[model samples]
Target: MMSLYLLNTKNTYTVAALMEIAKELGKEDWDFSQNPCDGNPNWVTPTGNLSQSKNVVICTCAHNDSCHVVNITLMRQDLTGVLPPSLAKLPSIKVINLAFNYLNGTIPNEWASTKLEFISLSGNRLSGSIPTFLSNITTLGYLSLENNLFSGKVPAELGQLKNLYLL
Candidate 1:
């Protein structure tokens, strides 16, 4: 697997460009196909006094032309500010696991376009209604929005995701 430091260098450490580097990285052979934090106990980010800006690591490595499957996981970090809406532009995005952070904002409507299989946004300060557009993604399997300050009823449109196993 490519190291985070390496990814930073290759992409000039910008959030938008990192996705492209990640896609290229995926072209190479690697043992870990899923998010790196999946099997480790320390995968969870620690709370309290974490770096304010040192939060998320979003890697988008979806290949152009092909149906890219970008894998993203932001475990334990001190991420702040609104999530960049441009993230939804990555067509190959599949898994998005972001648990235990200080993200405060609304879930972007654009996220509905990605045919995501796993999406976890637990333990954050996110508010507002869960976008009904999420139902547009039919491939969603795992979804979690617990422990957030989100108000409003869960959109019934999400019921259309037949593959969802977790909420």
Candidate 2:
């Protein structure tokens, strides 16, 4: 029963980030009138279960009495635009997948400080060498940048990620 206002401050920021994403991607089907978590059925997974929704998933922290976004998946949605830096504002986000879209731009440097575990931007038009700061994310385990326009040698710094199993 999480409402937009009831979510934590970080979650509110994530909502704004999502708005920017929807706008940039030309997601005309995005419904702004409904609560992002409860209103959009298309945002949910085909399994017909709320918890399994592919578009957005909310996680609750009972110890802190707060709710936050943990994952965002927008695969093959025909989205276009630069990856917004606002996405880095989701304090509790662990996974981000925007593969198979038309997005282009260097991955935002602001994301270097996040606690993400998985990031995938494959099959897009993104350019620029992979950020070295990505190696700083100790929690990162999966990263995908294939089929893009990136240049430069793979950073040896990426070898620093002890938990990273994929590139």
CA-lDDT, candidates in order: 0.59, 0.75
Task: For residues 43-113, write the lDDT of model 1, one tens digit per residue.
Answer: 22345535542222334343431222366565555456555465566566777766777777888776777
Question: Which whole-number lDDT from 0 to 100 does residue 49 have in model 2?
Answer: 51
Q: Estimate each model's TM-score.
A: 0.62, 0.81
TM-score (C-alpha) between model 2 and the true structure: 0.81
Q: List the residue pairs that clash in candidate 1.
A: 22-61, 23-61, 45-76
Model 2 lDDT tens row, 60-164: 465664556678787777778877677677788898888888899899888888899999999999998988988888899999999999999889999989999
